[model samples]
Target: MHDALLSALSTVNDPELHRDLVSLGMIERAELLSGVAHVKVNLTTPACPLKGRIEADVRAAVLEVPGVQDVQVTFGATVRQAAQPALPGVKHVVLIGSGKGGVGKSSVAVNLAASLARDGARVGLLDADVYGPSVAHMMGQGAARVTANEQRKMQPIEAHGLRFLSMANLSPAGQALVWRGPMLHSAIQQFIKDAAWGELDYLIVDLPPGTGDVQLSLTQTVQVTGAVIVTTPQDVALIDAARAIDMFRKASVPVLGIVENMSYFVAPDTGHTYDLFGRGGSRKLGEQYPLLGEVPLNVEVRQDADQGIPAVLAHPETAAAQALIQVARNLAGQVSVRALSQSLADLPDQLTVV
Candidate 1:
């Protein structure tokens, strides 16, 4: 009976991973008693967007086994650590980058980290935009008092369910950072190593606009999981976004996907949706990379962000907030898929565990 149940489940493939559950080691337990089957399906991440569909597939597949009159299914998740050569205490380092400014890259970074933390993962937010750091302000950290532990490691500020750090907080009031190569390099290295980031599942870095030294510095500093490009649905923005994608490719960093921000607007009075920044600009890029989501322009999101509250937490039911949350989940799924693929790459070719 156990063999029969395992055989049935081996035929069930993960929707996103494209492999059987048994082979992937997602079936934590499978038991048979009194002609009823009991099973548990452990997913890659708690924020899996297709969890409902996977659960349904499990039920359908197990029900097909003869003599199993009933089946009970439960779900749990464990985010896979990035294929090593990864950073110490950090499972994934995701960069939220943009081609030019004014596209809300920092906003996406903050919300993405918050969304993941809300889903029960230890998350960190690193503002690597040395020239223009806004994470301290966006997360409502006005007088950020960064302290050092006994080992003299800088401790991250806690905000919005994330361990946050930013150059803005470390610098004095109303002063510009005129530091060049050596100074910039030292700062990034300290942020990556000297900081006391303990066992984070995701470290979302908000990179400054364009493909510049900071981007190169980050790639050289650590093994990055991937990058997510944020752009508006306009020709100018899309052109720069394409350049950003090319830069990641050149750096040997995976381009996770593209997110079209300020994609459209809707009137509160008449319920009319208008394409404020032109339409379908991301379609061309979508051919090469996944279009994670199209986030609408909302005055409330702007107001909430200014007030140091992420939209995903401030207004969960709002369209813009929901879109961002969905984008976050999609990003998590992509990270898990990439990690699993890399791990499989190092294993024997003939994986017959299932």
Candidate 2:
């Protein structure tokens, strides 16, 4: 009966959450004795909007099993803790960063994380852009605080099958975060060190634009697997992007690849593509560094961003999504290593200043 009850939980899915309660780690414990069932589950948020539905499904699943006389269901909320020992299984920690703002780094990070999650990889995204942490908004999660589990470990908010941590989760809605350098860096460090990111295949950190103190601090502290530079295909953007790459190179963090955002715009009425942001800047920069892929400007991608649904998940068949997925797959292939030894091996033989 216990085994059957557990199996039934595998069938109960969280509709809005879009993950099986079992896979979401919602079912903490289950016991059956003398045809009676006892179960405990953890929820992602306090006042979960789906509490009633989730409870109903749990009861139904356990009762449907044969020889179940009485079923006991328990629910609890997750909280944030100070810290936990690191999980050694996290393979890659990719930083999706850029030198200038408005290059769509967060969009690339969010979509890429979703794409990687779809490919059966355990992915996590840390919104390191303290001033503009848009990952929570992009992922459709309202302002909420993270929780800590029984082991006193910080529990990350789950959305689209990927675990996430961001300053937006901590700040109140509609309020501007006016924090200083030391405080911002400390908060970023806490989000990285304190959160319980278990066995992640890739942990993508969306960094703030330019080579600021936060960027320097992260590269110094965390073992950044590599960094993907996001830039628009324009002369000015390329100049700043090159400076960003130089910063990473000086720090000895290998440039995994470069992704050009808003590379081109395609008109809806006619099958014509316009070079809105100029042409070949990204390609020229790619020639300077390791080029990954370029994502064109698409209405569908913009629409998905507006609705908090990543284009990779909302419209996986689109060309833009495909391009993002390819970049993600490429990033996933990189091996994880510490120190500057293996990472700096791929630096351009001759550094070019833009």
Candidate 3:
């Protein structure tokens, strides 16, 4: 019965952690007596957002086990503010961010997650863009809510084999967060520390645009492995991207590389290409730092994001998807720096410190 319970738990995942509850070391205790089974699950935070779903999953898994007649599922949590994986192996934490909105930061994050998942790597995405969480919309989990364990810690929502979290998961659509920096910091802190993010090869955090309080708070709280800057080919956008790089550098966070979005437009009818936002800005930025790749202004990319299926998953063979895949591969290779390094460029004596 013990083995049976463990087997069933293999299918039950801690949504935020993105790993099987059993494998994540979240299943604290499980037993079967006279065909009645009781299980206790643990979480990482006091106000975990995923308690309900955890109980339901535990109940479902135990009931499916043979000799389990009645199932009582309970939850618990670790006292640690941030729960690292039980194992001490290295797991990369990548922050996908931008200095300006409409640059497809979330789209890049989702597509990158899907692309990495396609390559068989364990991946998780966090919609840290508190003021504008769209990972739910992009990943098709917008209506999905996180469940908590008995301790009331949050459980991530799963979709397409990727575990995800977003403010949208906690509240209904169109509801304002009405949260300030400290509140945002606490919420994000719990999201990282209290939620059980398990044995992941890559944990992608989709941050809000600009170098704001949330981004600053994240750098101070979570030991981010790296960062990815998203921008367009426009000069104005590049200027902001530079500022973002400076901020990350100030915080001692490494920048993996830069991704240029809406780089160009290709005419569907005549097979002609247009540099919609002008060209060379990304190349110039890449010259200063490392340039990952440029994503074209493809309609399918936008459509896929709106449809809750990343372009990489929805159209793997398309040019847009192929380009994103290459970017993902490059990003996967960038493990040495934490995103700040790659994006930083030495400024003139006067502007250097700022």
Best by TM-score: 1
- Alpha carbon lDDT at 225, candidate 2: 65
Give residue 157's error in model 2 in angstroms. 0.5
Residue-wise C-alpha lDDT for candidate 1, range 119-213, written one tens digit per residue = 87889999999999888887889578688988999999998778988988898867899988788888999999899998888899999999988
13-68 per-residue lDDT for model 2 (tens digits): 76544556665556788888887798887764332445677888889988888888
Worst lDDT run of 10 residues, candidate 1, spans 345-354
Candidate 3 residue lDDT tens string, 1-354: 677787787788766545566655567778898888978876543223456777888888789887788998876544221123322332667789888898888899999888877766667888999988899999987778889977776887878777888988888899888888899999888888777666666788999999999999988886777689999989899999998999999988778899998888889899898998987687776876778888888999999888889999888887778889888866765542222122223212121100
Q: What lDDT would each prediction earn against the true structure?
A: 0.88, 0.76, 0.77
Residue pairs with clashing backbones, model 2? 78-147, 79-147, 79-148, 80-147, 80-148
TM-score of each: 0.95, 0.70, 0.70
Mark the regions of model 1 whose C-alpha exceeds 4 Å error after superposition: 33-36, 345-354
Local lDDT at 204 for model 1: 93
Clashing pairs in 1: none
**Global CA lDDT of candidate 3, please?**
0.77
The segments of candidate 3 whose C-alpha lies over 4 angstroms from its true place after superposition are 1-90, 336-354
Best by lDDT: 1
